[model samples]
Target: MTLLSWSVIEYSAKYDAAGELGHVRDTIKWGADYLLKTFNSTADTIDALVAQVGSAATAPGSTQPDDQYCWMRPEEIDYPRPVIECQSCPDLAAEMAAALAAASIVFKDNRAYSRELLHGATTVWNFASDRAGNSSYLHRVIDSNLARQAGAFSAGKDHGVFSWDNKLPGAQLLMSRLWLFLSPGYPYEDMLRTFQSQTSIIMCSYLPVFKSFNRTKGGLIQLNHGMPQPLQYVANAAFLASVYSDYLEAADTPGWNCGPDFYSVEVLRSFAMTQIKYILGKNPLKMSYVVGYGQNYPKHVHHRGASIPKKGGDRGCTGGWHWRDSKEPNPNVIAGAMVAGPDRHDGFKDVRKNRNYTEATLAGNAGLVAALVALSGDEHGLDKNTMFSAVPSMFPSPPPPPAPWKP
Candidate 1:
């Protein structure tokens, strides 16, 4: 079912790009068929999910309700309303609007969804305004939903609030995508403000404390602590630099990991690199790094001297053998090197020896490389295909004025 939905969206996107009426018709047909299939197979499951969510929302001592289930409520109510002709029908007009906007891509005949998408964007704008007006720490309120949910949990110990922090990013990402398609008249100033404000907090609080060491050269230097390497900082820098290339100079800073784990590093680097490339017109392929080989040693090595675990025997006697061997380059550093050079050479080796790669050695520095490539229009030794999907589309035509809603 998920795959079907994804394919429908994907094909619809292609059809939209082609702008062929017949293709659009075919795309809509496919989407409607998939929707019918989903409705038939998952009707009971959907009903159950909606009921559960509604009950939770209405129950005594109910706290913050989950938005996922809340979204489903509108879906369930809207899906059935279009099929029924009763005077006292469910009021799922909002949900219907969202669904129609989503489906309109596939069914070009329904341009009405474009207006719905704009309305939804306005709704978000309004919510953001309301929160900003009321909250003292507007930045914190906008940056994370965790604090809000935590407060709810404290207030209502018996009835837990469903946390929204994890889901907020995805929601924002989607809304931003839809807004791109709808091109609403309202400025994206609020969204940009929130992003920049959060970025500033991250830079001020974390970037200064990152510690850098030439793992190959064997020396520890405190650069900054808690610096979210290639992910948050690098990505943020890349975005800023793209917007105002002068900031690229600031990209040269050592990065530090908040948590010492492969997954954490991977997530940070991948997300940062991807965003940098997308925003700065850089080659994503060049940003790609190898993982699981301990190839990039300097980035992973702890500046503090390494220690071996003690080995003990059953007889309360210490064993001569060390539990784990201490190596100059941590063998477990299995991660890919950031893409570098117009030739797309593995930049890891240059940085690994710690000879010249300084703050410039930061993985996000690749964004600078991208910026250079883009500015120079250098096609040589660059992979265009890596960023083919990341390029933004032309602004969609302004939606027709919304029709008056009938009761």
Candidate 2:
């Protein structure tokens, strides 16, 4: 949701000129409104929220196959789905805050709607901070211990990817960006600074030269952290890398220093573009991970909606197995949909049943959209170089030129 908001917010001018801004806003509003409904906005104190609706299973003990177990259209489900509510979940609350905050930016032209979104952001951010007190207490204790022992402290292990389950990195980046747009004398200035610092750390960790993450032989950033199915995460990582570069450009920062190494913004952007190109058919197999793109792409994407024929009569939960197992290309093309990508060796199997390499997820596509917008030419058709200057030196200036030879 946050990524979608970012896509429209960062590129609204370009999209508006292209006559697509209204459509994007309508789509983002649909999602934001649904998220708003998950909790009671009017309540004096917000706590729990409906975290999930339904599941892979249709009911507690029903023999009917559910969405995950069978290749059925969502419209075919006739059961009342169960819901999962959560309380005291800081991570979830923080992510909601990020989404609402970013959406508020997208609708800033609509004063009333923007205000409502900001209010929701404030509510959830408070909830997250309140629930995270225990962690803050532990950190304080650790700080005191270190003060007494004069011991060095580390920032601990880094997360390999910014993902749905782990929203800290993305949330922090959003919160920090919010600081720039907020009014003066904001009470949360300190917290926003912390967010900025943490966001910088996460981006620095992705530097290939830093050896913090592995890169595929084809130059795709691989932050799988040893997961068997890793390509699902590459899109999200690429999104963050691109978005961070946009942030740096917005702040007029030529580059950032990570310890002894000073990385120019070009370095960061180069890393992001590499990942994007790899997904768009720069890999060993020369296959585009996105459907309906490039000369070669995945034909048998693992999605029931795409696989089943529009005119077919066998659209039932159990009856679609023939289409699912069929060797033919999908009757419907999910254009611009990014599927889970190739293996470590840049190898990909185009078979429909290979869900690990064939599934197209909303989160993955959200990231892809935002990343594409960020890397595209700036607003008013201005190239990025025209808007931002050349890279500056990260170290001391060189000695002055020698005295003139002529007198």
Candidate 3:
């Protein structure tokens, strides 16, 4: 699920780097189309989305002929696929809202698809917000399902496979950004109110001032989770930074200045860029957590399908367990996947089972896409409708300088 949302946001920017616009559109559209299938614009229920695949009461692939310890292929799995839907969860609704809204921009040239995305985004947001008070009921439904099923079902109280407590603000901001774009700067009453409400929550409650979300000398966002601290808030910070960059553009201050505003654009960009560089190989670990990118990286990604085809020392019964430094390199390469990352001291322990350091999924990379695209000077018409279109028209270039003097 995280992979679905994160894929759209990051793949678009990845295409920007590679100049493969068609591939980027194709990659993002795949996830966006599936997400649309999960949602119903007229209804305010989870029926629009499939809460679980495979065994509803048990884990995926649990029905295979092989035992629990054996590898079971997806085609061989047979189980009752029960779909669950409810209205109490706001987090998934909000994520879908953000995902579809962002994709709306990606498909802006396609009027019907873009409008459909907006409708879906608005529907999910209203659905979630209407039942915000009843969100606590989620635990009951999930726990009851877990009781009924004798398999490894991902039954829990949370609204997602992973919690989205810190991610809500970013989701809201992205949705708000899409709202503004679709409005074409003509803000409607409901849309404007939603934007204001979301922006206030972020600026007044979750920014550098918030104590529960921020507790560090360096201002790293921290949560009470057992995993590393920065993972909780860094991505959202990057998203917020992109949103802030948009804010700065609208303000149109001379030379992209900062500090005059309550939350400076420069501060936001600095935090976003630092976190991005850290993931791209700029820490004490000195390893790029992004697979197949730069410097040293974790070879043994904690992904089942990506590693299933390996051979030799890299492919035994326990071959996937080769996370230690002495282990053979993982034969399969999962490119552009951002793994679970480093500790506060910039230390990384790479292993397939190390969810703290080696787990990589689509959810973690969504913000990576935002950071990269914003850092790319809005090359893909994100902030602008067309690339290099109006800049030269608005401000004529000064004459070139004389040939530089050779040393």
lDDT scores of the candidates, listed in order: 0.29, 0.70, 0.53
| Candidates sorted on lDDT, descending | 2, 3, 1
Give model 1 RMSD, 1 decimal. 19.2
**Local accuracy of candidate 2 as per-residue lDDT tens digits, 1-407:** 78788667666766667687797788789888887787875553587887888767656665566556567555565544678898878778778877887788888779899888877776776677664322242233224353233211235444536777765566566655654433123344655665666677777888877778777788766777544445556767777777677667666767777887778878877877788888898888889888999879999999888988776635676677888889999998999899988877777888898888898888888878767766776522212321112123224578999998996
Error of 1 at 44 (Å): 17
- For model 3, residues 62-98, the per-residue Cα lDDT tens digits are 5332323333223333433456665466667767776
Window of ten residues with lowest summed lDDT in model 2? 382-391
Tell me, by TM-score, which candidate is best.
2
What is the Cα root-mean-square deviation between model 2 and the actual structure?
A: 10.0
Q: Number of clashes in every candidate structure?
A: 16, 0, 3
For lDDT, the strongest prediction is 2
In terms of lDDT, the poorest run of 10 residues in model 3 is 152-161
Q: Which of 2 and 3 is ahead in lDDT? A: 2
Q: Of 1 and 2, which scores higher on lDDT?
A: 2
Q: Where does model 2 exceed 4 Å of error? A: 17-19, 46-48, 57-64, 87-90, 119-160, 174-197, 226-232, 313-315, 378-407
| Candidate 1 stretches greater than 4 Å from native | 1-110, 113-147, 150-196, 203-407
TM-score of each model, paired residue for residue: 0.23, 0.77, 0.61
Error (Å) of candidate 1 at residue 238 is: 6.0
Candidates 1 and 3 compared: the better one by lDDT is 3
